[model samples]
Target: MMMFRPIFASLFGATLFVATVLPAIAQETLPSWSDGAAKTRILDFVKATTTEGGEGFVAPQDRIAVFDNDGTLWPEQPYYVQLGFILDRVKTLAPQHPEWKTKEPFKSILAGDLKGIARGGEKGIVDLVMSTHAGMTSDQFAKIVTDWFATAKHPKTGKPFDEMGYLPMRELLDYLRDNGFKTYIVSGGGVEFMRPITEKAYGIPPEQVVGSTILTEYAIVGDVPVLRRLPKIDFVDDGPGKPSGINKFIGRKPIFVAGNSDGDAEMLRWVTAAKGPGFAMIVHHTDAEREYAYDRESAFGKLDRALNEAERRNWLVVDMKADWKTIYASEH
Candidate 1:
């Protein structure tokens, strides 16, 4: 989830979908958010930070906002959308790798033994990602991800994966941009995988997206220069890595951050704990009907430590069921 590069913007070759998805900038901000303290916090922070001569006033150049992609912007259960991609990919490539029938995670994945797959643990997950995600040129991999997005649907709603962005959050993004905040996505998802669809779905260009990455090298293949993806992780933009990745990519502390899960705990603390005018928000997935609800015990987006820390840090914990007048981008 973080440009990634101009390549993604060029490959996508489309303009922002905000005009159709959200109201004009001059209209009411976050209209899909129900009246509450959560909404008020966002409004108050934005107002205080943008106003001239105010104690919290932040220059437009300094007004940066970073957001986590999975649970924060969309649903993460029954599992992450990227995991769905991984599982499908493992199947698609299985016929070529017959030995996968005996491989630890692959065997379980093919047999639909999620518990067995989990038994393989983090190494198993990394192996799965590297096997399918690397070994191609960056351009080729991006196309593969984009093509998958063209057809991938959420298991629950049967809607296109990219189409499931939360409507209220989308409005919040547009609203922040309208007020001069440069928004970025700092997520654990692969940067290239997300770059293809983020601009169209969230009105955030590829260059503004940051996420986990694998190694890549410049090479000349068939007399043409290309960057080839390698089967080695370069960085992971989650948990403690989120803050470091932000510093390396953006070169400044953001005034606002949004996320859901303990994986984003460090980012939340890093932003809000800054000297002044910083706001951190957690999108509490509490709506079991409009959206699936689980917090402490959820495997996909566990939100325990961050939920407990929100009160002490004064971070806004958005109760999805209570605070969202609408859940999905399509709801608008």
Candidate 2:
């Protein structure tokens, strides 16, 4: 009877072990986000929307998440990539327009006078882009962007432009996709400029990207159909333009939206205003040690208005210094 009791106790202990281990195994198999409330909230939202019997269960088609490209997904420091392209363009075109050596914005750019360039502001940026990006066919523009991205490296990091992407953001993107979310890049950079490299860098295909665009015209160039880039601005995917771009390009409002600055305020507002369940987040760059950090005073990714709005709305504002264990994957 004592031997039988010992065997029974051993079997009971084994059963308890299995019961405890199986659930932990199951949970471990699930995609684990960074350790924090933000990760938990994101996982919870995704689970609620994807689970079969959950109240927020959404069809695969409706699982749309839109993310801002610059600053949100990657580092947009020293200025946006489009600005880099424009600066390079200025350098390239400088020889032809030697007068640019004496001009205000062009001269500032040629001389690498960043302070003078800063003084030019939004109007300066617009003029530079219009001058450089226009006159070429859309195909030419695409090829130009592809060539530039292949060669250009970030100034401070000395890494390829694509490699500067935020590591945690990439993980989040993959996790969302695994859970059936279709992620889209909504950016203020030119659509053509981003289309060539976004898929390789961010796991978002060209079809899922929306950005600033110039008017184009279809014409036959030597019996080949071509789209010529016109100087006319079709759209600028910043501020209010963001929501409009999403509506025009994606048609359906996104269930999840992530952005970094006041430029993305309207997009966040638009997503949160949808009739049903929605989530919005803003990445607050606060870690100067790991990566570049600036908020309200910075020209790029300025966060004042967005911070206030995020607080008022109870939106998640991820602090890079606090939330992230690391910044870029390359650094790790």
Candidate 3:
């Protein structure tokens, strides 16, 4: 009991609560979610999986759910939150590295040239991340990221970066945990970067997060042992890498997975293709009034291929405009 107890997000949690709990609790499960097929499907999946004797019933230990962070949990419009961090970090460290004044991506970043940065593609973004995110001890890097979140405000929302997580999704995390599901974040963003704010912003702890990571090694400094952050990337938990990372780090095949962009296509595919009952959903960006809406052609959070694949795979395509009652945490 000691070993399995901790893995369960909510012991005595799952379908029983939904069946026996008050109407208010049921309504509160996903308060920000509008009444629609999307909502119905999610609730139904939980019910089925938690109903013991039912064909869809899954054991408590098998109830694993994974989510993509940026676009799914919060807005990744204009630019990714991590990319925003990278840009700001470059500027912050620019005074220390005077050579960055004339560097390609660094120079473009300092000039506020999003177009130039885009021109460099994924390679350029990776380079920028390595430059800004590495060289310090792991603990030092985490502290820097935590400090950045404390003061960094979104250009569009004017809210702190930590304040932008989707309230509906936050509710969903609680709902799943209430239903005995172990929730984990498998995002493309840096693991260390996401770990700082995840537990407070969302309910997930640092141990449950799996994401892209740079290399790190143990070293003694000033009579203290520490894991030093290295510039070389160790793994990228996105696109095709998502499934591989999950297999490598998480071990268990998740029964539920949610994502927002093409970067999440393979993850959705991987989860839904499994032998048992699996549920996959894509948070489609469709509300221009409350949030930015673009797919297929958008540079950031493009949802083209996965959007197309949803129908064939029986995946839930959540229409943000029509399905969500509110967009941000403050909206509710």
Candidate 4:
């Protein structure tokens, strides 16, 4: 019976090893991802690009990464967060713009009639955006957005819009940054609108964000200089416009690009077309239980052409349901 003592001690040590050592071994950069092809491909790409003297080694200065904001980073369904802000702004400033009370798009927005707003299509949506996003000084616009996010919540999730960012993507961003890649947000959403929230949400600073913008003019108000957002369309950073925005803003073709829809197709095309090793990935929203999942025929973040193109080009297609173990950054 005394001979059994050492064996029992060995069994206790093995249990301790299983509890502690196995977990540490499993610790990975993307904790929200299930260890599978999607995660493996991403990690492999990062490793290849980052390894010193490796065939795919990208110089630190040239390690540019561009990401889409709306559906790519956070949730975009049920209208974009920016559009939500505009609808709320229509309500906030309706008392001031009394004519907007009965205005076509503005009236629809104010009444919380999204179906009505959708019927107006591109022209009506543009009208709503211009009215709400323009007229204020750039500083004032920032302040308005900053304040709106304080109280706004996603109608479906009931979580703050800022907290809706995906854990896997956030990990991807940090992981890339850690590997010396400079990340930038290139979205169809308004640049001014995203700059205020991105740093806190994605660790991307305001200067690195590029998006649609209305022209601004220098003015003096009460002896203080200000840049007032004019009521003119400067650029629309969507569809084909994404690549143009990338060239005009980042000035270098990105080595890495991640987007979720057809809107990002051109950007991915341009980035991958560059004459060297590059990676283009699309985040396919597939989790309806954790987040809204719409693609192909969806009005926003339509994934049809992009999905086919990604498959043809052999780009990474991250199926959110299968690839990710957790969706939100706050989730374990």
Candidate 5:
């Protein structure tokens, strides 16, 4: 009788809690999102997955949503924020590495020549990252990233880089989290670089971030054991790597995935291809007024293959110009 009484009370309490919470979920959701198919689709998915005894209902622990950091959550146009960090780091470290003045990528970087950096391609960028991001301990690198974000401003918006996360997307993150979904940033940007500001910017913690990373070596600095950053590529969490990183870190396939470029194709493909009811959305940079709009030919955040795939798969494509009433948070 005692065991039965306790179980009945627990069940009654859960029912009463759901009775009060479900209506709130249905009513107040994504206020920043404009009225459109994109908004409707997102709400529908959340409802289906969150409602009790629904066919698409997902357990709260299983309700994982992954998002690409660049372009999707924030602007990655003109140049990637991490690349800018590397350039700044180069200038700061130039006195230590005197030969950088004569080096190819370093020479051009010091001269503030974006054209030369572009010409250096993936290899040049990797070189720059290795030179600037490496050689420091992991803790030191994290401090450098946090310090950089304190002052770095977006060239176009003139706002601090940390202040440039998309308003609608930030709202979506909060909405999903409020609806029992765990939001994670699965980006091609550096893991260390993104970790410092992700918590403040997106409400996602550093532990939930997965991104490209460099190898680090364990060392003893006096009495402290430290992981010193090495100038070697450990992982590139872009394209197919996104899914791999997601699986590695989150240990579960996300039911919802948001991305802004072809680099995120495989991640979306992995998510939507799963057996259950899944949702995938691509952020099409259509608003030239609020943000930069280049897809196929853009050096950063190229949205070609993923754009075509989204259309063919009937996935929601968010038109920044029409769908989002405001772009940046400051706009609101």
Candidate 6:
């Protein structure tokens, strides 16, 4: 009986030991991020939130993190994927319309004159989207996106559109999840377009994504109720609209937010303004050889205002040329 008592106590002790150490071991085995101040701050923030007795400790459910998609999660040049989708749509639909052959933006797109298409500016891009994406049911639009992402390839890299995502950002997303953060993507791109592919690319489910949306309505298509996507813009999740969308959709201020341009300034401001600990990071594209580099003068993802604000606020500005060990995962 005495020997049996000792054996039971040892087994109980071993069980306790495993219970205490298993989680730590699991955390330690997470992918190693680069050794830099940005990585250090990220790890420290996670530890503070997840570890008991830490001042920044937040319950797992409240550990919300938001990211901007285009230039943040993935590459946005030679152009945004949504733009490519629209261009393809223009090409496909041009035969039906015929007038597009003479239309300014559509004409440039059809002629493979990207510079001319961009010359139409943001308004040009918006016109292209409205022309191609509007007048379709939401289900029909979703099918278009699903089909395009399946076959679309980057012009320069010749990789699937899905493969153009930044490798380091993907690792950051996983790291946050490992630490119990629920990540959301808030982007200026069309919500429907992003929702179709984000889950596969970012590990963020569709429900957690926020972006520009068009008005939708319920309709009965042949006795089956269906939600139809309308072209009337409901919201544009860019700049200040990013913060507005976050509040409307998430209902809670994020503890972590990351973006890459002036379009993200308001979102970072909103997140950093939270009562307690928070992190705001900006991904600065500076590696021209590995990836395109543009900031103040670039037509998209311009960083001037946000860059200054980040510097003034001591927020992390990820130098693509310096901080990242690798750019796109495919490059590695």
Best by TM-score: 4
Itemize residue pairs with steric clashes in candidate 2. Answer: none
Candidate 4: which pairs clash? none
Residue-level lDDT tens digits of model 5 in 1-332 = 89899899989988987899877766766766788889999989999999999999999999999999999998887888887788889899999988988887888988988788878888988888888889999999889999999999988889997789998999999999999999999999999999999999999999999999999999999999999999999999999899999989889989999999999999999899999978999999988877977899997898899989998887889988888888877875
Query: Which is the better candidate, 5 or 6, if ranked by lDDT?
Result: 5
- TM-score of structure candidate 6: 0.89
**lDDT of each model, Cα atoms only?**
0.92, 0.87, 0.90, 0.90, 0.90, 0.86
Minimum summed lDDT over a 10-residue window in model 6 is located at 25-34
**TM-score, each model?**
0.91, 0.89, 0.91, 0.92, 0.91, 0.89
What is candidate 4's TM-score against the reference? 0.92
Model 5 gets an lDDT of: 0.90
lDDT of 4: 0.90
Tens-digit lDDT string for candidate 3 (85-112):
8888898889998998887788898998
Residues 1-332, candidate 4, lDDT per residue (tens digit)? 88999999999999999899888866657888898998998899989999999999989999999999999999888778888888888888898898977878877777777788878878987788888888989999999999999899987888897798888889999999999999999999999999999998899999999999999999999999999999888999999999999889989989999999999999998888889888999999888888878899898788999999998999999989999899886665
Model 6's number of clashes is 1
What tens digits encode model 2's per-residue C-alpha lDDT throughout 167-213? 88988888789888899999998899899999889888999999999
**lDDT per residue, candidate 1, 1-332, as tens digits?**
34566767755543454554344644777889998899998999999999999988999999999999999998899889999999999999999999999988999999998888789999999999999999999999999999899999999999997789999999999999999999999999999999999998899999999999999999999999999999999999889999999999999999999999999999999998889889999999988888998999988889999999998888899999999999886765
In candidate 2, how many Å is residue 272 off? Answer: 1.1
- The digit string of per-residue lDDT tens for model 6 on 136-172 reads 7878888989999999998778888678778888888
- Name the regions of candidate 4 deviating beyond 4 angstroms: 1-27
* Error at 278, model 1, angstroms: 0.2
